[model samples]
Target: MDIFVVDDERIIAETLAIILRNHGYSAETFFSAEHALASIGKSPRLLLTDFRMGRMSGIDLAMEAHSRIDCSVILFSSDLQECDREWQMLQKRDSRCTLLRKPLHPARLLQQVRLSLSTEPRLGLHVS
Candidate 1:
């Protein structure tokens, strides 16, 4: 299963990708939503994106990608309260969407990833 990590901060995206890769998962990093969208054909099993970004927000990217593919989306934001409305709207649209706060703990991130994958069989992902 492939995991795509998107963050405007290059280090964050790359580090997340490396961590996922180290854990026996195939992963890639994208510094921009546009670039990630362009590569949607890769059909990532999961999307780990920063909620606030230049030009496009993570919710927007997830919505567009979910429209095209059946994948689980995990959005991270430093300011969670600011995106409450957006989160509610996304949940109404797709229950598969999940939120995680920024400055993520490695263990929590991995747990969420596994939980998301296990819970959403439509994503066609096998954890083991």
Candidate 2:
């Protein structure tokens, strides 16, 4: 599956990309939403974005991306207290999207990714 990761934090983006790549997935990293959106037509299977980017928020990125192409979006944030708000907002717009608290357990992240991808009908992640 092809995954696009967007984050102002390069380390986080690269680390997630490495993890996804190790799982035999094609991953792309973008430091900005604008840069990533430029290639939105490529149709990534999933999107992983940081919630608190300085210029453009992840929610905005997801919205823009989803408008261009159908995909599953997982929004991550260090502020766990904001999770409920994030979840509610995303669910209102796209239920297939998920909000994950940052400093996430790698195992849990992978598991959620597996489950989300498998269950999402339009993205075609083919988790098996």
Candidate 3:
């Protein structure tokens, strides 16, 4: 698969996955970080997830996924300002990940996905 779209909100995850699929990319939806992690037998190229979720934070999942597989991560939050601590930890620990502040613009999301699929990974907090 090309990507795994995870969010605590099932509808959001499903919708994102569908959008990516409609754009000719392979994608899957997971309602929680744990479920995404559990299903990563053969990790997809990218993991797009929500920053806050039950039981596990997105950073924790990203770290764990990076440890187990070679995939990039994109974490989204309604307010990036409130997630400074988590964001800092993630930035210090990894460069193949990005934080996208919510109300994501579909075009920007697709652009980032394309850029992420390139030979190199990009690291900048994208607020689209």
Candidate 4:
């Protein structure tokens, strides 16, 4: 599946992209929501964004992505409290969005990604 990794931290973005690529997934890294949104038309299967990005937040990205593409979104934040509202909003959307705490265990993150992508039907494009 094609995935977009958006994080202001270059290392984090590149690392996640590398891990996704190693697992046989097509992944790209972006430093901002704007850059990531530019590729939404490509219809990536997943959007992995940092919750505390400088300009545009992950919640905003998720909302825009839901409108523009069929993809599951995984929002990562170091502060769990900061994610509470966004998590609730995601649950309301019912569009397969998940909140992932930062400083994540690589293996655990991968597992969650697998679960989110599997349960999220919109990630796959319908040819018909």
Candidate 5:
């Protein structure tokens, strides 16, 4: 499955992509939401994005991407409390949306990706 990693910080996005690639997944990296959105064709199997971006937030990216294709989104944020309301609202609208706190452990991120892309549909919110 294809995965897209979007982050304003180039290093973060690239590093994540490399990690996913090393794990045998086809992954791509984008430094901005606009770049990723413009490049998205059929939508990837998963989108791993940073919640707080300059022009477009991860939530915005997720919303737009969801409108175009059926895919799962995993949003990473440093301040989870600040986005709690928005996250809950997103969950109500899209059961496939999930939130992972920043400073993520590589193993946890991989686990979440697996769960999000699993054949068995996962319901409700996932915060880690």
Candidate 6:
């Protein structure tokens, strides 16, 4: 998979995936982090996941994906404060994670995706 768009909200997840697909990239949608985790690691892929979700938060999934496949992650949430608190624990020089707020524009999402995939190592936490 080129990218995994995960969110508890079905519409958001699918819509993001569709947008990515329309942009000429492979994309998949998962309604829960667990489902996405189960399907990952055949190869490293980028992840665009909602920060808060069932069973596991996006940060939790990102940590696991990094450990398993060194995947890049883009975590989004309406709850900015909570996302920030959780993300602070994971920031490091070699980390490849980005945080975005909700109501994300399609242009911005595409921009982030390009940026995330264009680079290999991403240091610090990129928030927008």
C-alpha RMSD values across all candidates: 4.5, 4.4, 1.2, 5.9, 1.2, 1.6
Candidate rank order under lDDT: 5, 3, 1, 6, 4, 2
What would the per-residue lDDT of candidate 5 be over residues 1-128, giving only the tens digit for each residue?
Answer: 48999999999998889888988889989999999899878479999999999899999999899999889999999999988888888887898988989887889889888888898987645575
Q: Which is the better candidate, 1 or 5, if ranked by lDDT?
A: 5
lDDT tens readout by residue for model 4, 1-128: 47899999999999999998898888989999989988788888889889888788888988888887778888888887856766676667754777777786789778867876785363321110
Alpha-carbon shift of residue 60 in model 3 (angstroms): 0.9
- Could you tell me every candidate's TM-score relative to the true structure? 0.91, 0.86, 0.94, 0.88, 0.94, 0.91
Model 1 deviation from native, Cα RMSD in Å? 4.5
Q: Candidate 6: RMSD over Cα atoms?
A: 1.6
- What ranking emerges by TM-score with the best candidate at the front? 5, 3, 6, 1, 4, 2
- What tens digits encode model 6's per-residue C-alpha lDDT throughout 34-71? 99889886554688899899889888888888778867
* Model 4 stretches astray by more than 4 angstroms: 119-128
Write model 2 residue lDDT over 33-95, tens digit each, in one string: 888888888899788888788787888888888888878888888784655565566667776
Model 3 C-alpha lDDT per residue in residues 1-128, reported as the tens digit of each score: 89999999998998899889999999989988999999988679999999999998888899899889998888888988888787888888888888887877898889888877778657755464
lDDT to native, each model: 0.86, 0.77, 0.86, 0.80, 0.88, 0.83
TM-score-superior candidate, 4 or 6: 6
Candidate 2 off by > 4 Å: 83-87, 119-128
For candidate 1, list the clashing residue pairs, or say none. Answer: none
Pairs of colliding residues, candidate 2: none
> By lDDT, is 2 or 5 better?
5
lDDT of 1 by residue, 13-65 (tens): 99999889889889989999999999999999899999899999999999999
